[model samples]
Target: MFKLFKHLAFCAAFLVAVSASAHSFKIGELEVIHPHARPTTPGIQNGVAWFGVKNAGASDDRVIGVESPIADHAEIHDMTMDNDVMRMFKVDGVPVPAGETVTLGQGNKLHVMLMGLKQPLKEGDAFDMTVHFEKAGSVPVQVWVEQPSAASGAMQHQEDQHDHSAH
Candidate 1:
């Protein structure tokens, strides 16, 4: 009775929240899904954003650039460990093969560096970013600020496991 009604209400609210947080944008044959970044401290000047690009077409594409108003500049970067120290370097692009999905986060080793952030990225906040593709052109997306999920615990360590084209 009352308990059942309360449970149903909770479920409804949960569904709404999930749908609101799940975002995607499409440009040509590429679909940019759930672009997100971890919340950062007030004094942190740099942050990273991650997303997956799904290429449904019969050709390959590369993410050549990124632009965000919240940062002075953004570039594709790769994070890896060299010896016992971590190293990050700028990359020319991240390739998205034909009929494949390329993820830039969740331990896949590539992320976009939002350099010189204008403000701290707080949880539950979102900002606009444009992803430039060599073939598909630029697609505008909203990057959500959120905490890392338990499944993405590897992100907390800053360790990554993929290789990319270095510039």
Candidate 2:
């Protein structure tokens, strides 16, 4: 019967729609287009992953959690400055609002701390990480390991030189 065929087609279409949304984790007003990540060290169990998140939407969103297979733990961390001393702390989340971009960069050092890595992360290698947003759910970020050299990290505050200079 025509009605029976129409019912079947409708059910099929509905199932497809649900699956499309279920497959991806989303971010605020952004698509997380081709997300990439890289670790900090080579031949070491400890590592970090950086991502370039661009806001494609009109409103902002924040990152709250990170999940990955490389490590038993993935912590959301931030660097804090106290007078002449600098320290790192684990934060619950990070905000990347709409119409703006947030880069997980070196030194100012917001990182995805990969603890208990099965193996060392090397440059030119990429791995999978799922970043969770307050509203965007969990989006997968592909991370690659690239060491930050002295030329880059040394010129910056470096976290090694606590000169107490107020520039």
Candidate 3:
């Protein structure tokens, strides 16, 4: 009886953890998954947010805008290497192809620039933001502040150790 109870407890805890990390928001035919950002240090006025947009509809959509209470303003920006120099520029919108997923985050060259941050973003903290889609309308998302490697599972084996030391 004690072993059964222990097993059930473990399963319950596992389910909760999985559900908490699998958060996503849907608007129209678009699904926004796991909006997240990295922790910002003090005196930093700028930060970036990243997420993946999956379009399930037949037509393509575009991410036009982003609004967050944690920042003075936000804009969609893309990075490119030009003449051996890295350049970041503001874009009107990011195209999300039909039946495809576009990821905006580290190494993806696209991200949401949160300008004039109201406060420093700390690990384990969460903030609310609205992602505007051209065809899907606006979708509200909760962005989690986590380490890049941990959130993307680039260091999955060290995730537990990282979380323990980070938090």
Best by TM-score: 1
Q: Give TM-scores for every candidate, taking all chains together and pairing residue i with residue i.
A: 0.82, 0.64, 0.75
Against the true structure, candidate 1 has what lDDT?
0.85
Candidate 1 residues lying further than 4 Å off, grouped into runs, are 1-20, 159-167
What does the lDDT come to for candidate 3? Answer: 0.80
For 76-135, candidate 2 gives per-residue lDDT tens digits of 766666775765677898788888877665335676666678777767677888888887
Which candidate, 1 or 2, would have the higher lDDT against the true structure? 1
Task: Give Cα-based local distance difference scores for all models.
Answer: 0.85, 0.63, 0.80
- RMSD to true structure for each model, in Å: 5.0, 14.4, 7.4
Candidate 2 minimal-lDDT segment of 10 residues = 158-167
| Model 3: ten consecutive residues of lowest lDDT | 158-167
Give the C-alpha miss distance for residue 7 in model 3, angstroms. 22
- Per-residue lDDT of model 1, residues 1-167, tens digit only: 99999999999998898788778999989999899988989997787888999999999999999999999999987776777566778889999999999988654778888888999999999999999999999999999999886666677556333322232
Clashes of each: 0, 10, 0
Q: How much RMSD separates candidate 3 from the native structure?
A: 7.4
Order the candidate numbers by lDDT, best to worst.
1, 3, 2
